[model samples]
Target: MPLKELAERRAILHRKSDPQTIVKHALDDVQLGKVAMVSSFGAESVVLLHMISQTAPDTPILFIDTEMLFPETLQYQKDVAEELGLTNVQVVKPSREKLLEQDVDGILHTIDPDACCALRKTQPLEDALEGYDAWITGRKRYQSGSRAELPVYEKSGRKIKINPLADWNAAKLVAYIEEHNLPKHPLVARGFQSLGCAPCTTKTKPGEDPRAGRWRGQDKSECGIHIVDGKVVRQRNAA
Candidate 1:
């Protein structure tokens, strides 16, 4: 389909429906070359994972294993995907050669998180999504100030980014998880509302922003994926 037609459809869908309706349409779009669900499999990700499992289990689910992630998160990802019966779970990772060149000591999160993230999270996915026309995310507006104005569909370069749960809140996420008996990210109960690389993430305290646990003290809130492209683009916005 032409970009104009898709833009018009996105506008109408954004106004007339709920998250599920919007998500369904994006999955059903035939003109997009390929679509994938980039999930962190963090606290609120189960809602979207479960939705896609039911609506389109065969769709590619890209999970970035930054190699710095929590072990609990790794296990949780495996369990959730299997339990949901989601097929095509692709694990994307940064290359060892690049790590040796750019982040040799592996303490890049201490020196420069954005650069580390670009190498570990963004580039690999960018390579992975060479021809994909769009991807879906679980980001919600209530998570942070930057994402407060997130739209269901965003045109990024030549690709369409889908935030199926853009209107969902903390309570809605909890309700979905409980209602579906979805497994929580292993760190949530310990107060990690957001999960990212182990070196950068911390546990959130009461009254802090939902994503305060991520890149804790750094002024950086995003890992640059949201600003540019790939789960490759799914960077800093999601869990």
Candidate 2:
């Protein structure tokens, strides 16, 4: 099916259902090789990775290594992928030439993070997702200001984006992780409630928003991977 029609269909089915039910139904439509799960391998990522590993260990898992991530995050990604015994994990990366061409100055993120994200993340994944009909994500509505109203399913160009935890809160995510004994990003233990690129993330204070550490002190929230109504907008700022 075309992406728009599939999205419309998904929306119709998810009108009143919860996130788990939506994921269950989406899995039923899987044909083994047509779907993929895209994970940020961030703080709250383990829950969805665990779910997918349990649901379909053989499913291709796409992990985008933005090349700017923390060493701990890269290690965590490797650790989780191995521990879960995920058979088809593929690490996608931005081209070296592209990185050199676009960000040789290394301050593109400082001047325009949206462009940096587009260069390192969005473009790479968009290219990698060429043949996949749908991809799963771990976005929860309560994570940040921008994601406060996320939907279970969304249309992104020619692909279907599924947010299986759209209705979940932080407490629920923590419970799920603890119950599964899931591995979290190492930075999480050091007060980094959220994890992104090394330069863009920081440690949050008590009672600060979970995503307050991302792009700290900057007016950037989301890394442009997910957009709203076809326009990219920052969901939160690291205050």
Candidate 3:
């Protein structure tokens, strides 16, 4: 279950079939009641969530509630879950002791965003994902820097990571949302192209990169939840 072996296993799976095939295979092969989906409830998350809800409504949907997130995000999460009729939308949160120990100053995001993300997102997710054999994600290829090369299926230790939207683009996402009359995050229309924690996100201007607002002014971009190889590489830092 080492990182290297996991990557090797993921590579082998990727070579065997395309992304769509991988998703179908995972859905069919993974044991019932043992799978879950991790959703950010961001700009384009509804597409995959809808797909999963239709394909497997009973599957548990895990949403991380980092206390630093915008209030609008929390509302949107509820709306989306209700609209989609998601049966099991469990909200995972970081433990108070862990947050107090790591973010006692409440300014860790400004001084050390990586560590803050590790505490709020990575560690909490690692804990939430325990006992699951496979999980679904909403990653797409045309999203940003590193995500442009995302694979459909990956191996994370002993668990299977499935990206059902790996081949989707921004235009397709928007189109699907509109066609379905899905509710969007309020910040999306206000120029916040990419939404994350309140302080880490900003509104972008025309011609500016969609993710430019994330960790603005700083070299930091991703929150380290999605890693590559054995190291934690941010989405913006890659490629």
Candidate 4:
């Protein structure tokens, strides 16, 4: 389908529909063709994951392990999946050959963060999403500047990216988690409101944006996973 039509469909989907309804529509619609849920298992992630679990327990949940993530995140991924009974949780990782060729020492993030994220995140996720026509995300408008206008469905490359929580805010997320008794990522307690690979992630300061810690002191906001108008909008920080 053309991008314009997809936008129209997104408008219809967003009209009077809640987060769980969007998730259910994506998973149950055969036209979507092999849907998967991509999650970082970060703070506020369990809300969407829990929605997916309740909607469809066996939905494919792709968790990218950049291999540089915090040990806490790694354990949290396992714990959340088991706790939610998410049977098809797939642990995706950067390619061994690609890592050897590009970031053998795993310090590429220190030199060029965008290139590092492309290698460790974008490319690996592209590979993992090869056969899928649609994928779900836990992204919200409150996350970052780039995602401030996030839609319920977006056209990314050849796939339809679904953001069920696009309209959600921090308060709603907390309430949902509290009501569901969902597990939170361990690092959130340490001030890491937005979790990513350990090397680029730091604890956010009080009154700062939740994503302030990611790629701190850098002009980067997103990790290159978010594509807009068929282009990667990785560095959205303007001088």
lDDT against true structure, model 4: 0.86
Q: Report the C-alpha lDDT of model 1 over 90-133, residue by residue, as the tens digit.
A: 99999999999999899887787888999999788777777688
Q: Compose the digit string of candidate 3's lDDT tens values, residues 1-239.
A: 65345545655665656444655556776342267889989877778778777777767888999899999899999998888889889899988998888897678888888888888888898889897877888887775676777776666555667786788777888888898888888888888877889988888877676677888877777787776543676545332
Clash totals for all candidate models: 3, 1, 0, 0
Best by lDDT: 4
Give the C-alpha miss distance for residue 51 in model 3, angstroms: 0.9
Considering every candidate listed, which one attains the maximal TM-score? 4
The deviation in Å at residue 50 for candidate 2 is 0.6
RMSD, one per candidate, in order: 3.2, 2.5, 3.3, 1.6
lDDT of 1: 0.82
Alpha carbon lDDT of residue 20, candidate 1? 75
- The reply for model 1, stretches above 4 Å from the true place, is 1-5, 228-239
Clashes of 4: 0
Alpha carbon lDDT of residue 18, candidate 1? 77
The lDDT-based order of candidates, best leading, equals 4, 1, 2, 3
TM-score, per-candidate, Cα-based? 0.91, 0.89, 0.86, 0.95
Clash list (residue pairs), candidate 1? 229-233, 230-233, 230-234
Q: What is the full ranking by TM-score, best candidate first? A: 4, 1, 2, 3
